[model samples]
Each structure stands twice: as C-alpha cells, then as structure tokens.
Target chain A: MNRLTALVIAFALLLFAPARALDIQLTSGDWQPINIFVELFLGEENLNGQIPSDIIADDLTVSGNFRAYKENQNHANAMSAERLGDIRNRGGEYLITGTVNNKSGKQYTLSFTLYDTLTNDKIGSYSIVFNNENQRLVAHNVSNWIYETILSKAGIFHTKVAYVVRHEDGTNELKVADYDGHNRLVMLTSQDHIISPTWTANGNSLLYVSFEQNKPVIYQQSLLTGERSIVANFKGSNSAPAASPDNRTIAAALTEHGGLQQIYLLSGNRKARLRESKGIDTEPVFSPDSKHLAFISDESGSPQIYQFNLDDNKTRRLTFGSRYNVSPDYSAQGDVLTLVRRDENGDNISILDIRNGDTIPLTNTASTNSPSFAPNGDVISFIDDRNKKNLATVSVNGKVIVFWRDSEQGEIINPSWSPIKSDWF
Target chain B: MKKQNFASLATIFFALVLTGCAASKGAYSGNIEDDRSGEAGLAPVSAGTAGKASSPGFVKSSTIDDERTSTDSLLQKRIIYFDYDKSAVRDEALPILHTHAEFLNNKGGAIGIVLGGHADNRGSNEYNLALGQRRANAVRDIFLSYGASANDIEAISFGEEQPRAQGDNESAWQENRRVEIRYTDE
Candidate 1:
C-alpha cells in the first residue's frame, strides 16, 4: 500500500537519467515482468552446485513478477561490465550470483549478490547459513530477499499452506506444507470432518473446526509442539473460527445463542455476541486492521456477504446480485475481499473491491469454496471441484492459475494460505 | 490434543497391517510416499476411488426383523427425505414422525433419539451445515410438539460430509438431502 517509499523515489530518479534504451519500472500495475538471470552458484571446491540457484529461478518465475533465467556458467566474475552489457542487450534487467559453502557434514551456507543490470549497480547481498535439510527453504528466503529489495513487497515463497485431505477410508487429515505443496506434515488425522483451518496472527498455531466430539468444536493447536486446547465447545455448532490481527480476539459463528448461527467475538474467557439476526449468519472473517468483520448472513433472504465495523457497530451489505455468497476473506491491504458465489451455473470464486463496488469473477467452475488471499494480496487460493477435487491458486489479475492435489485417490479441500513465515522458522 | 499421537497410531496401524491383524479390505495399502506425490504445477489426472456408504445410523436397519408389526413397519422408514434447500417436512413424512413421537412419549423412561441432519454437496460447506441444522431443528420441533420429551432428543448437523450417494447428479443430491432418525440405546 505504501507505493511512494524511498526505494520508489530512487527508482524514479534513476528512471529520469535513462541507463538503457529499454524501458523498465518496478511497480505493481500493467508493467511487464522484469527479466532476471541467475548464474549457477559457485560451490566451495568449484563443485558447480545448482540446487539453490535452480530454486531461486523457479521462485522468481512462479511469483509472476519476474521472468527468471539461469546462466550456464558460475564464477566470481560472471557479471563483469562486458557480460552485464550483454545481459542488458538481451533485456535482462537484473542478475543474481551466489556461492554455496558446505560447512561441516550437514550445514551449508548460501550467499547471494543482487545487481541491477541496466544501471550496473550492486543492489544488495544476503547470506544464509542453514542445515542441508532446509536447502529449499533457505533458497526461498534468498528469493524473498531479492523480491523485497526489487519490488518493495514481501514474497510468499517462504509461507506455508494449511488444508484438509480426506483419505480413501473417510478419515480426514489436516496437513500443512510449503506454499508449493511440498514438505507436508500431517497435523491431525481423525475419522471425523475438519473444516476452516486458519493460521494465528503470529503464525505459531492454527484454529479449526473438528467434529470429533459428534459436534463441531473449534480448537487452537500449536504447529511446533502439537499441543492443542479447545477454543469453543458450545451446545450447538461452533464453527468458522477467524483470528484477528491482534493475537487476542477470535470471531466465530456459534449457535449456542438460541440455537441459530450468529457471529460472536471471543476473547480470553469472555464471549460477546456481535449480531442479532433472525436468519443464519456464519463465516466471520476479520480485516487486516482488525477494525471490521465480514461475514455471510441470510437476513436478506439469501446468503450474502456483509461487512460490520467494530467502531460504529454498523453493517453494510457487500454483494447484491448473487443469491448465494459465503466464505468471505480480506486481503492483507484490506482493500479487496474474496468470496464464493453460487448461481445457476455453479459455485465460483470472486473478488470485490471495497473502495468501489466492482466485483470480478476469478473462476467459472462449479463447487469452488473457501477463497483465501495471500499475504501479499497478489494471489487467491481456493478449492476447485469441477472435475476433480484439488487446491487451486490464481493470480489476482487472473493471468496465472495453478492446481495442487495431494494424491490421486483422496479429496483435498479447505485451503488457507498462511502469513509470511516468521523468523523463528 | 497432540498430533504426534497420530504418527504413533499410524505406526501401530502399519504394524497391525504387517502382522495381518487389521482388515485388509479398507486399509490404506499404498506406500507412504504415494500420499505425497503432488507435483508443483500439475494436477493429478487419475480418477478417485468410489465412495462408500456413509449413513450415520446408530444401530437401526431399514427393514423390520422377525414378524413385521405395524409399529415396526412405521419405524422402518427412518429416513425423512427433503427437497433441495428446503427444511420443511414433506406431507408424506409426517405420519412416520408422528409414530416416532408417540412411540417415544408412551415409553416408560427416557429413550434418547438423535436427528442427524445432512445436505447435498451443492453449496459452501459452512452454509450447508447451517442448512442442515435448520432441517434438524425443524424435525426436533415437530417431535417436541407431538409429545416427545425435549430432553430425549438431540439434533446435530453433519452437513455434506456424510453423503449416502456419491454421484454428482440430482438423484444423489436428493438421496443425500435428508434427516436420519437414529435411536440411541441408553
């Protein structure tokens, strides 16, 4: 959201003094993706390592903001001014060269230097020493650093995604993995159903609904220690748990109040009902600023998304044309909200800009549910069940779409992308 | 709850399978690595296995046992089907529900009953859960009005998680959108 920072100022000043005949800019809109080249990482004994470099290139390309290419050679002087001129001639705007040092048996050090090819200026350098088992993560961190330094926004390469996978025997497993659906760790396996898995504000725990007790109950479980405690276990359904930006409060849809679903703000040992509606109200999601809550209510005859402000205690309808709309989530910037709408065609994902009431459909497939936004607000993830059940992610601009499935036999649903990985990981 | 116990349980299950002590029919027989075969940018093109029966019946059967009495015949219709998205009990379903209510009311003591509400896999899961709860509440209110004790009935919604049919068609949806009257023997 902070578009006019010192980095943008430096970019603007450099833009006036034209370094090359090719036009290049670092902004979010219709600008083309900058071409970046990564030279193979130089190993400690000139072993010619390609693991980290390959991961870095793939990360940049998957981001959709950069077209990354890997050079065939690796050396200290690979980016000499002559070679840099050649790169500029071929529309390469950035270059990354790194070194991999294998310290001891399982420890490794990856050091990278970023350069702006057009201006021939050294942008920055990052060094990460990690266990060899975390090679992919360390490489992703390097890519994140390069991305933040260039685009002035955090990259989601290091984040994780939590989802539910139903096995062939009707057992549901709650799994968390890297953003690309690798390095999966099963959090819980139960014969009951699990729904609405969300990350805590600090990214240390997850809150979800499980039917293990023969009724839906919300539980907050730590990802590190695997310890969990029940958050809500009312008489009726306690589902759709949404944690606020502050680590204190949780918004959930509970039916304990007169047996009809209503939104409630739960904090510590106190619970306060927020809305009094005659119809069904569930799926309460908090804005990034924690000043407003968006939820699905059928008070208007059909399920539709509504936003309620915490300050004024006033509510406004968000979606008008749809007879069925639910599962509302806000982007990190709190500018846009993603939801699923059902019509004569089928259930599909759509995004609504709060500033202007413009709604754009993201997917046309039926059975799409639980659309969630990435921390960077550039991508949205949802479950698509048109032909096969799978987790899908689409760029906010709808230009790039990717699907992920755990296996060929089970059903994967309820995907929630986590915030950027904290430093503890 | 701790998740490490899941790993331990899985280890025990694998041990049981190795020793041929567990049911080999429905057990997961594939390698552990097979569950983690999701590629980075590709979706699997293989078809999923056929869905099995998932009706949440406690101990009741759809057919009568021994001599078919009138009460047994009435109780045989445990499932009360509903129209799509409508929770109101159909006219044809009222006679069986009345019989259940009278049977529970005339009993000497409290006999627990659970109404497991379900929906077709058509809408959002959360919304479907809400709809199922509504259907369960509707049936519970009718039972209460017909002289059934409120203390003896508990209603819970399973949403679309437990579907009796697997096909993505109107027939399957109609079969799935119903409430099952389960008698919990105390």
Candidate 2:
C-alpha cells in the first residue's frame, strides 16, 4: 500500500512539472530551479590542484537561478549520447563539461562547453584565460559565461568587495577581498579612523577618508601600484567619495565654506560645487550612466535621499514618508536604489524603484547599514550590526539572505561591492 | 581655590584615563614640564583684570605650577558630550566651551587646534559623519566668536569610527557622541 501511494504521488508530480526547461518562468518563486550537473574539468586538478566544477556549481547555486550538483561517475571530458541520457534521467536540465589547457608559465586557458540535456543539443563552447595567481577567477569567468548565455544578464561572481575592519587596538585596516570574503589584501592601515571606502569605476584604485592627519582627508590609492594621492584635503571634513561611472569624476562632501557639508564634483584639478545648502548634503553615489548623482541631504528638515541631475543641475527628492533615510547606492541599471531607511523600529535596508516611488524592504533586521548593490543588481551586501558587527547579502527580491561572521577580530563596516571587472588582480 | 583646583584636576585626570587620551599614558609626567615651555609666552591674567581676559574665575596667579595645573585641569575637560542626534551645545557644556574659547582667543596664532567630532553607531556612517561635523563646527563656532583665528582651527568628523565606549547601550552612545578638542602637535 505504501509503494502504491508513493507511485501515485510521483505520477502526480510528473504531471504537474513543467514540460520544458525553457518554459519555466525565471521570475516566479514556485518554479523549480534549473538543475545543472557540473563535471570536473579535464587537467583542472593537475594544473592548479583545484577543481573549477565545484566553484562553478557553488556560484550557480548562490545565484538563486539554478540548482547545481556534481557528477563524479562520468570522468569523460566529452559528452556522449548515453551519458547525456543518464544525466537527463537524474533531473539535470543542463550539463557543463570543460577542459584546462596550460598555455605557459602562470598562464592557463579554461575551455567550457554548455549542453542542453533535454534537447541533447550543444549550446556553445567558450574559453577564458587567466594568468593571475587566483585560480578561482577561471571558475568565476566560466560561471559568468554560463549565466550570461542562459539569463542574458551579467554575472557578479568575479567582482570584489572593499570594506574596513576595525581592530581592537584602535587601528583600522581598509581591505579588499573576493566576493566570497576570501583572499583578502589589506590596502591601507592607519592608527586613526578610516571610513567611506569607495572604488573607481574601473576597479583600479580606491577613494577613502583617513584621519591620519587628525582630520578627515580623502585619499585615492591605486590597487595596482599601491601609490596613494590626496583627492580632497579641505579645511573642514572631506568625505563620502563616490566615483563616477565615466571614471573621470568623483563626488564628495566637503565642509569648506562655513563648516556646513555640501556636495562637490572633483574631476582632474577642477572642482565644482554641486549644491549649496544650510543643511547637510553628503553620501553621493553616481548612477550607472553618470547622468545623475543620488545623495543624502537633510535640507528637508530630515535626512532623505536626493538626486542631482548633471544636465540641468535640478534636484529632486527620491525618498519620503520616512524621517531618516540616507546612504543611497544606485543599481547598475540605474532603475533602483538600495539605501538605509530608519524608522521607529530601527534601521533597515530597502530598495526603491526609480521609475515609480515604490519601496521594498530587503532587510527586516533592526540595524543594518551601508547597503550596496552587487554588479548584477540582483543582490545587496551590507553591514548588519544588530548584535555583533557582521556582513550580510540579500537578494533584491528579498528571497535569499546570507550572513558571514567576521572570522577575525573586530567589526566589519562599510562594505562596498566592486563593479564587474574582467581582471581578477 | 587650591582645594577646588585639586578636586577638578583629579576629575580631569580620571576623565583623561577614561577617554583614552594619549596624555594619560606614562609619557604624561615628563611631558607636562615640556608642554609648559610651549605655553611659556602666555601670561596669566590678574583677577578681575581687563583686556582679552573673559573668564574672571580663571585668573592666573604668580604661583606658576598651580596656575599651569589649573589650566591643564580646564583643558583636560576636552570632550563635550551631546544628546542623541543633537549637535547643539548643551547648557552644562557651555562653561567648558567658554573656557576653551578664552584659551583659544588668548593663545592667538601660537598653536593650531583640531576639533575631532564623532557619533554613535546608531545611524548611517556618512550621515553620522555630517552630524559629527556639525558638532565639531558648533564647538568651533564658539571659539571663532571669541576671536580665535579660523586658520588656527580645523574641525573634522570621525563619524562612528572612534567610540569611547563599545557597548550598545545608552551610556555608551552618550559617551561616543562627542567632540574631542586636541592640539595639533599632540
């Protein structure tokens, strides 16, 4: 009787399941994730002593679009009809097979072929080479290829994140780490306070404020050469550096004239003050096209997000109904903004659709700060300080939330996700 | 007056320890005598005297050590605490600011001072930075009103980075929301 009931349930599930993988709607939550079987790349373990298939699978799964599993039974690099049939029976809608070819010293090429298991058709084959010491970049690149081929959207697995770690000894270290919070490199260390670390559009350098001279001074440091240059060292506080998408301008807040903070755009040696207000204007973030800058200004008697149009210099408010809303970060598509909205319940991260004035709460935590959008515009990374300070990332739809504890001492603050860059180093 | 000076001096000493001021470290003792050299040009104002001297109660006497110690006592009250989200100077902290203003007005261009403002971990970092900048500017306004040179003063905000207390309670928040006045040479 139990076997009969199980068979009936299985039949019912088969009848209800979507007929084709392409028919599955990516927007709905009720649909099953597209199953992918990743086979270890040939010569991958021999070249770098690392498996790219595992990383690829993890990236696909973390993307919330696909469910990936490893296939160890098939050691063949090339897909066969019988093997494809076996994978199709195991619920794999897609299969990924790859090989590694060593080009030269420290240079290796990763070749990948994506397959549609249901149709038994080869989608395409792509290859990416990496000479950097980080072998993980190859896998991330492969995942990006698969993601873009399938979803028609860019992948953020290869991007980096910049954050500040405050040590117990009163020193702060500005660090850049991979998106997974590994392979960290300390960019700057100062005995005094350091805050507001931002990245250049090209991801070549960083702009941040350091109190090493007993006052906040904005400095731009190159990640490639480790050279540092002062961007803004005005009389009063100079902070909240946001690089323009064009890579030619940086918007920062300076308390120059009367100690009232105002936004300014600094490009090359010419500085242009954007706004003049009696109240505070800060936390400037440029849109993807650099056409407008969304910033925090308290000119409305309460802190709120405002957008400054570069073409006409007209200002419009983006957030309302809340007394306190600051720290605005624009999405890659420039359609939505991720920011912190504070109310009676405490601070929560919310995303605002720019087309309409609708707001969606991405974090329900009482105290979350510094919400920055991933390059893909599907996720946001922020600092959750409800208890101890930690890092968290949430999908834009508020469906997936992941928390990462600070494995080292001290609290992690000011998490800024880097834009999508081609090079890992 | 001597007794009052001793009591406030001890209190300031404890405050220095609590605020983690560098002067409270072991280098404090020997540096006290050296620090006096920089202020040697400063002449003590006689009681109820006129000319630039604003605070009558802060009249300096010929007893050099007592006079210097009293000045140190007043200077050691470096931190000015603020209420939550409020940058305006409180009534209780006005007297301390007045003392600092008189000193800055008296010192003239001999020294440079930096007012490091800070905030608690409650709000966004950059907004708190602007808030902190407001508090520091508030303190700087008092000094400027007393005829202190704008060139000799630099007001900056550290936001929520440097907190005097690490707890997530009201007491810690109050302690963390403050403006710290320090001489540039320190």
Candidate 3:
C-alpha cells in the first residue's frame, strides 16, 4: 500500500471520470423531441391545467423539430432527484418544469426552468410577468429562449409582420403587427385602393402602391414617422415595386407606348428601362448582389419569372413548373426567390431555387398572394384568405402569427416585408 | 274685290307651310349646316353630328356620351396603341387628344378631372405604378397646355392594378394601356 498502489488508483479514477461527463452532440437527424412537464404552483393546491402546457408544447412543435409529450403529474409537489433520474433514463434529453403564480386578477408571474436531463444540470431559466391575453406570446418567448440556448441560434420570436388590410369602403390599408398578430397598427391609409406594401432596404420604411388619384402610384412612408413621399411614377401601370439592396434604385414594371410592360430602373430622379420585350414584362426583384433582377414576363407566351443580369443584360427564365408565375421577391441572402405560382387550382406562395430552378410550395392555401421574405429570410410572410377572412403573415408552418387581423375590416391583400431598416431612410 | 282678297290669303298660307316643312326636315336630319357651305350633301361638320344622327334621339344626349359609346363599340379606330414604355400620345390619338385639349381649354377651372394612367399587366407593381404616373403626367401635360390649371387636375397611375380586359391578349393589353380622363364633377 505504498506509491505503486496510489498511482494505480489515481489512473483508474481518471479513466472513469472522463466517461461520466456527458456531452451529447445532436445533429439534424439525431435530434430527439424535448419533453416538457409543467406544474402550476398556486399555493398548496396543484391546479391541473392543460392550457399552459399545451400552449408551450405547441409552440416548440411548430419549429418542426420537437415532439412534445403529455405526462401525468402524480408527483407534482415532489420533483425529487430519483424522479428526475427516471425521466432521464427514459431517453428524455431535456425537461421543462414551470410554476405560474397569479399576482392579480388577470396578471401572472411565470417562472420556468429548463434542465439538461443527461447532466441533471439546469441549462436555462426564465421568469416572465404577463397577463392572460399575452400568455401565448410569453410561452413562445420562453420556447424561443430555450431553442436559442440549445441550438445556439436566435429564434424568430420577436419579429413583426406587415400586410394589407382592405376596409369596408373598398380601400386597402397597410398594417403592421407582432409575429403573433397582436399590437396591430395601420401603416398606410388611403381612400383609393392600396396593394403590395414592400419593406424598403431599411425595415423602417414601407414601399407600396396607392390609387389615391385613380392611378397606381408607388409611395414610401416611414413606419416610425407618418411622413410619405413619391418614389417613382412611370407610364401605364406600375404595380410591383421592389427596392434594390443598396436602397438607391427601385426595379419597377413600366408600360411603354407599344402596350408592353417592361422592367425599368428608377434611381432618385433618373429612370432607365431595364428589360424590353414585346410580351408582358413585370415583377422585377434585385438579387442580393444587386447585379441581377428576377422578374416575371409573358415573353414565353405564359407568365414565367426571368432573371436578367444588370451587367450583361442577358435574360434567363427561372421558373418552369407553372405556366403562370408572378410576384417575385428576392431573399435577403439572394439565394432563393419567393413568388406566387398560379395554376388551375388558384394561387400559392412558392420558393424557387435560383441554382436548380426547382420550385417548392410554401403555402398550400389557395389564393395566397404577395409572398415576401423576411429580412432574415428564415420565414416567408404572405396574405391568405380563410373562411372569407383575410389574414396577414400566414406562415407556411402553422405558427398562427399575425401582424394584423380585422375580421370586420374587410379583406387583406398584398403583403411585402420591408427591407432591413437603416438609419438613413 | 272679295276674290282678290281670298287669292292673296291662300298665297300667304302656302308660303308659311312650305317654310315650316323645310325647317323641320333640316333639324330632323341632325346635321349642322356648314357656315361656309349650306350643302346637305356635304359631310357632317364634325363626326360627332353623324354619330348623334346614327344613334336615334332616344339614346344618350351628352356630347361625350355619343363619342365614348361610338369609340368603345368600334375598337379598331378607338384605341390608340403605344410603343413599349412610351407614354407620348401617338399620332392616331392626336385627334382625341385635341378634343380633350379643347374641352380642357373651354372648361378650365369649371371641372376637376383626374387622368388615370394605366399599364398592361406585364411588369412589377412598382414599375407599373411609376409607369402609370408617367402616362398620367403625359396626359396631364397635354391638358395643362390646353389651358387646364395643374391644380384643377391630378394625375394618378394605376400601374397594372386595374385592367379593362382580363385576357393577356394584344386587344386586352391595348385597352389597358390608356390614360382615362375621369371627371370628379361634371
């Protein structure tokens, strides 16, 4: 029992110690569903409520990654070490348990803890004060926090939505709301019709079409300030106006004398026609590099999106699956193009791969139009008509997030995301 | 003495009846007699007179009504087509433009009108919107030069938002690429 025995014992302990430390690296395929259990501590009585648990679980599941479980809370008051060990042994990598204390008539303080089951260590915790009305949003915020801590990426929880709301007087009103469709405010209002509210290079300003004088005019207004001004005025119909990445020029469809719609560049006060064709040409979107413009035209006898190089002026058709495709909005990254593809069944928002020319349907709902990519390009927002009600920011994934919803305000159409907001404009 | 008086009365009655019949026939024909030449065989002073006569009296009565109806029905000569991305009033549209100019000059501040410039459904919404503005400005310029005040008129471009015809055909597009003069108060 001397120096030799002590050295052997030290080496044996070092070998087993490293194995006891658990550090699981999850992949896209290897990732498992996180099971969450919540117990509302309202004093001594443990209230059995599925509302908060279901809401939180639903929020996580919508990310298309998590599969939530519903378990009985037999030992709600006693969440002992032995019980937690049993939950981890059952292949649950993560566990969430929270307590909600009602402070006032409708207000409540929710304190939650997220645990990494493998290490039995508290990875993250959140305490939010909210009312009954904001329970859904609070749940989403907590879920987002957990997602970011676990995935090491920010979730799209705090993003807002932009959409068009039609009034009873047949006037279109541009509106902005939170991602969950709360705190809605009208951005643009006119007695005449308004359509296609596109976010400027800066997310603070919105570029949209207004028929105040009976002609469609593109106007830019600040979301923070109500100040508005005319950006471009072209001949014939000017419907779709997309701002370039630099935010200096706007790519628009201008109708010339030959009765053909052509793409034009309107920068400051100078105007130059970009693409000229005998057939109908419209819907111009600038690539991320600001060197190419993706637009729609009937040059091929049917409406299809075409990408035109700003330098070489060579044009190539981007969409081939549908005979009709319009309303092309380039993503912030300029990798994918979000547009509306119409067929016999009606219209649906689709994402087109610029490299492969393959189109993937983003929204299955018919009559989904004016699909726009968020500045981050992780989510696509569009207008959808459901049960005769126009809903803005109808996500392809059933996130039920909205910037505005006025069931009685009439139909909402044409939603465009603002460009990333800059300090200049 | 009695026979001479009766013969004079008969002569007077015949003259009055003949004059009345001639005047009625001229008015019923719906042709404005030329100030230079009072010839019935000559063409109507303006195509407007012929249009009025062709469509019976029971039809609409406004001067612009007959012209609009006639132009709308006869599509071939009515629509003045344009080149790609040009808002300049074409040679064919000169006559109509002149008519509008004259109306603007005569009416002046008495009427407030909006020129709704439209584009065919072919371009992006913003491009069409700006293009519509250019078209509207073109018409507004013509009206202003003809004596209409800029304040009395507003030019708006409805870039490809509203279409007169739905089809993506040449005919439909021709109808869409137009700057319509809409009067707020007539």
Candidate 4:
C-alpha cells in the first residue's frame, strides 16, 4: 500500500479502537455466568435419585461462574440434541443430565453427561461406582469433574470451610461445612470464645486459636478424629495461626516473651522471631510460596497490614491508602492479598494486588473482615455483621456475594476456606 | 379509673419504701449533685443503725458525720470508654479511676483488683486484644502512680470478643471500647 493510504488506515483504526473497547465494556460480559439446567436421575432403586442432582446443581451455582436450576425431566436421554435445543431456547447455556442406579450389595452407579446447549456438543460423560455411605461424596466428585471438564478450571465443591460461630449465650464453636454450607458438623465447642480457624496443608486437619482455657491458645484438630492438641500455649496470647504450605512450620503471633505480641515461626518447641516491635503485631499469614509473612501492626500509629520477608527479614508496609487495614490472607497464587480496610463509613474487605500494590474494595457492607481465599483463588470467604454476624463469600472479580444464611442464628465471625482436596479427591 | 387508682397506689407504696430506704434526709434516689457520696454506701450494708455496737468515746454516731461513700450504682459505674484505636484515659473517666486508685491506696494493697480491657469489633481480634490490654495497662499505670501496688493489679484483655453494644455504628463501638475495674474480693 502507498504511504497515504496506510496512514489513513492507521488513523481510522486508532479512531475505531476506543469505540470498540467501549462497546466491549458496555455489552453483557462474556464471563457472564452460564445458565445451567441439571436434569434428574432416572434409575434408582435403593437410594433417592434427587440427591445427586442437587449436589451438582449446588456445586455449579456456588462457583459463581454458572447459574444452575433443576430441570423438569428425569431421564438421561433428555440431553439429546432435540432436548438441548429446547434448553437453549429457554436460555440455558449448559445442560447436566444424569442417572443414579443401584448395582448390588450396597454399591451404586452414578453417571452424568454434560452438554453445550448452543453448539449441541457433548462435552463429556462421567461415571462412578460408590458405596451407599459415599453417595454424597460421589455426587461431589462428579460435580467437580463436570466443572473442570466444562469451565477448564478446578472446582472447589469437595472443599470444606471451617469457621468460628458465636452463639447467643456467648459461647463459641468451631464448625466445618461443605463449600455450599451444607452437611455442617461441629468440630469443637467451648464456653469461651474461639477465633481464626485455618486448615492445615493436608486439608484433613485444622489449626485454630481458642480461648477455651480463659487464655488464647492455638490448637490443632483432626477432622477425622475430632481430637485437638495444643499447638501454641504461650504466656500472653497465642492467636492467628497460619500453617505453612509445606506443613513443616506455623507462623503465629505470640506474646510469650517480652510481653509484647510479635510474629514468630513455631516449629516444635523452637521459635525464630519473624518481626519485632513495641507495637501490636497479630494475624500473621504466610504467602503462597511461604517465603514471607503479612500481619497486622500498629507501629505506624494505626493498625495496618505489613509484610515481612523471610530471607532478609526486611519489613515493609503493604497497605497505605487506608488508615486501618488488618486480618490479611493470601490467594492461592500469592498475587492478591485480601484484608479488611476501614474508612469513615465502616470496615470493608478489599483485595491488594501485591505485584502493583493496587487495592480494590470487594464489599460495600459496613463491617466485613477476616477474608480467606478459596484454593482456586476464585472466591474469598469473610465475615460481615450487617444483619447479624455471618460468613459470606465474595467472588474475586466482585460479582457474586453468597451469604451462608441457612445457618440458625449463625454468628459466624472468623472463616478460613480449606485448600483444594487435590491430594485426595 | 383503674390506671389512675393504680398510679396513686404505686405512689403511696413507693413513698413508704423510699422513706424507709433513704440514707439521708433528702430523696431516696440521690442526684449526682447530692455530694453525699459516703452516705450512699450505707444502704448497701443493709444493716440497720441499731446493729452497731455502742462503745465509749463514740459520742456521735459513726454515720452522723458528713461521711460520703460512693453508692452501689456509682461504684458499679466502672466502665471507661476510650476513643477509636486509642488506649489513653479519657478526661471524663479520670476522676472515676482516681477514686479507684485512692480506694486501693487506703487499703494499703490489702485488696487486689483486676482490670478487664476490651475493644470494638473494628479490627482483627488479636489486634483488638492487644489494644484492650494496652488500655488496661494504661489504667494499671495510672493506678500504680496513685500509690496502688503492682501486686494489687491484674490486667487482662478480652478484645472484640465480648462487646457491650451490638451495632456497627460508632455509638455502639464507642461503648464496646472500655476497661472495667473488678475487685478480686467481689
């Protein structure tokens, strides 16, 4: 092309580029959650068929990437092209059709087929043979498999979330539930208060701080046995225990020596100080790589989030925009840090991009704090007390907010989402 | 008619009760301006004036003098509120803390008191616990300077776990950030 024509084309492209960008921004985002319809199971002789369907529906809906609903039909054959056309006509993007059949001798077969309504493509089909007791677990595994197959992302349906709930009588209990806040089982209950429940790297154990003995002591509880062992019983306070990803050491705030709270790495009976100051330092969380620690400190006149390095022991402030920022935890990738920020209005949870130090507010509610990220880094669970103290999960992109409202007088305060069950599931 | 009759009946009953329970010649519920602080402590003793042993050289009744004792209600006003994220003693709470310090001093360290510190649910629980401890320590330091012994003081912090107020507003939060003085004997 000649120079004049090329220059004209370049100018036109520049002029149209911004307009296209604006149009893309204005339209319904392509990431808009897919509408999912889960069909009921057809073959079930020994167990209820709808249980598997509900599990899949809940798994997809809670992921924040899909909107799920139960379909009217109960046949696996309903996922054919003709049936899928009707689903697409009804604004369904994905169709999940399945069947649950009793094979014999307390064994059952559960299967599901995923279909793309728009393209009429059979994405994948999965099946599992599970014992009677593991019926619910089989459903969860199938949901995760369907999620990973369709969304190209790992699913957290099989994960567990442990949180401390304060009852009306001023007692506290450490409770664990499925990702959707279902199948809840109390792990520990104390007449005193308990705060900050975090999962160990194995995902089968928990590390939490409890005031069961009238003093704060960090304890480790096994999910399998319901037994707890004292992890840290320091003099002043032992609180905010964050288990390292390697499971070798725990970084917690201790006032054992000098009567001032500071971050320390506790392995067995030995502790190496991570950070020291006259000011208060607590809620120490490890980075995803376990190379650094971020905790709350008031050395700069107000409580703020600070990061201390492991290699050089250099301490640096990570939050500056807000006067009050605390209760910090990291994403699975360690690129984003979620913390509570306070302004004139009230306290709200926000995410800080560690790479650029850009903080983004995640919730507009008055008091939301103690955010812990899902293992996939897609959502962060925090506590807010607007109506009452309850556990809430917010999508990383700030699009979805799911409050675990099903709890009975649930005054859930401190929450930590368990890591991905990749080692088992 | 029943309400009016009940009101008059309640009035007559209250008048009789107040007259019997009044520690002074004035009204039963003394105003803050009553300045009869010592007289208020007598009502809590519940022992009638006739129970005291009359000894020689005690010409005047012990309760006859202008003795003032903090009333039960006044002594129970032990909560001291501080500003947000602050541990310093407020101006309004200084006199109350002073009264406590003097009571400790006059006892000559015979009695011990525990200062329970607390903070609002604004920050992390551990930080709030630390701040609450600092507030209690601030009170402990003030009490120590006023001749209160270190042995007579035990400071503990509950942080934001226990809140006196339940809302998310500043009014509730202000009440939650406080230090309460609890005598060990009680």
3 or 4, which is superior by DockQ? 3
Candidate 3's clash total is 61
How much of the real interface does each model capture, measured as fnat?
Answer: 0.13, 0.32, 0.15, 0.12
RMSD of each: 9.7, 13.1, 21.8, 17.6
Superposed model 2: Cα runs more than 4 Å off: A1-33, A40-50, A75-91, A99-111, A126-134, A387-390, A403-406, A422-424, B1-68, B71-73
**DockQ, all candidates in order:** 0.14, 0.15, 0.07, 0.06
What is the C-alpha lDDT profile of model 1 across B53-135, one tens digit per residue? Answer: 11122233455333224554787678989999899999899998998888777753334577878899887888888888788
Q: 1 or 3, which is superior by lDDT?
A: 1
lDDT of 4 by residue, B1-186 (tens): 332354345434433443354334332221111212233321111111222211111122334111124455345568998998788898788788888887777766545676778899866787888888789888888887778877566666778877889987899999999998866544
Q: Which parts of model 3 are misplaced by more than 4 Å?
A: A1-59, A67-93, A99-110, A117-121, A126-140, A256-259, A288-291, A310-313, A331-333, A363-366, A375-378, A385-388, A392-404, A418-425, B1-186
What TM-score does model 4 achieve against the real structure?
0.74
Candidate 1 C-alpha lDDT tens digits along A15-81: 4532221122222435466778788788833121227776677667666677676675765555588
lDDT of 4 by residue, A297-408 (tens): 8888888888888889898888886788888888888888998888778898888998889988878876777788999888888777665555678777776676653256
| Clash counts for all predictions | 0, 0, 61, 4
Comparing candidate 1 with candidate 4, which one achieves the higher DockQ? 1
How well does chain A score by TM in each candidate? 0.87, 0.84, 0.73, 0.85
Cα deviation at A178, candidate 4, in Å, is 1.1
